[model samples]
Target: MKYLVMVQGTQADYEGMRGKPSPGSPAWSEAELAAMYAYMGAISNDLSETGELVDAQGLAEPARTRLVTAGEDGKPVITDGPYSETKELMAGYWVLECESLERVTEIAARVTRCPGPEGITDYPVVIRPILDGAGDI
Candidate 1:
């Protein structure tokens, strides 16, 4: 089965883990930040070695995003960032071709341990099965 591992986090989550300290808080050392990235890379590398990794990439922050919708006359309407009512963002994703959902879930669980800030940092990875093209005309 092919699965999409959606890595969820915000820009704040990225910065906090990468050594940007909040007011009066200590910063993460360069080594710590490097280790975090290294861990993520290692996971990808392992999956690739096993021929399970189809694709993986990190996304630009929401500030660099744009929203497009249809206007009243059906023309394209564009809006700048800070999309309303959204709390979590998809920081990155990994596409893996694996044997089973249980295996994909295991991979996602390991991703949750990929190092983060001091407390309550939301770094969630969800595993979803890809649809196979069957019963099509």
Candidate 2:
């Protein structure tokens, strides 16, 4: 089964990673950020070697996002982003082909264990199975 493992964060979290913390989020030092990147990179490399990694990517900040919705007259309504600073958004994801939910869950748990500051790095790691075919639909 293929699964999407999402790492969630808020705009404040992004700011903190860049060494600019908002009210609730703490700043991440340069070394701390590098460690996180290294840890995640190692996981990706391992999965690539094992042929379990389908894709992995980190999204840009929410400020650069474009929000689209249907207008009242059926036209497309586009809103420039920078939504709520504290709103939770998908920061990155890993698409992995694993044998079972248990396997994916284990991997996700490891991802959550990536190094960070001593406190205030506890966010959710979302996982969902990808429906790939007509039968799955």
Candidate 3:
């Protein structure tokens, strides 16, 4: 089965990662950021080597994001936003083909171990099965 494992964060978290402290979030040190990168890299590398990794990506800052919805006249309405200081957004994701939910659960466990600055709490990493019978996934 294929699974999407995701990590979420807020704009404040993103700012802190980029060295701009916002409200409750503190700026991350270079070493702390490097450690996070290395930890996530090791997980991705292992998944790739084991033929379990399908795809992975870290999304851009929420400030650059756009929202789209259907207008009353049936046209597309696009606008900036849906990001806030406290609202959580997806920061990164990994698509993995695993033999069982147990295997994917183990992988998600590693994500929770990613190192970061003090006062930074570990956000929950979600895993959901993908419905991909159409071969488009």
Per-residue alpha-carbon lDDT of model 3 for 1-137, expressed as tens digits?
99999999887788899899866677999999999899999999999999999999998877878989999999999988654543778889999999999999999998998998888857899999998777655
lDDT of each: 0.79, 0.89, 0.89
Clashing pairs in 3: none
Candidate with best TM-score: 2
Better of 1 and 2 by lDDT: 2
Model 2 scores a TM of 0.92
Clashes of 3: 0
Q: Each candidate's root-mean-square deviation in Å? A: 3.0, 1.6, 2.6
- The TM-score values for the models, in the order shown, are 0.85, 0.92, 0.91
lDDT of 1: 0.79
Residue 135 C-alpha lDDT in model 1: 53
**Candidate 2 stretches greater than 4 Å from native:** none
Error of 1 at 102 (Å): 0.7
Ranking of all candidate structures by their TM-score, best first: 2, 3, 1
- For candidate 3, give the lDDT: 0.89
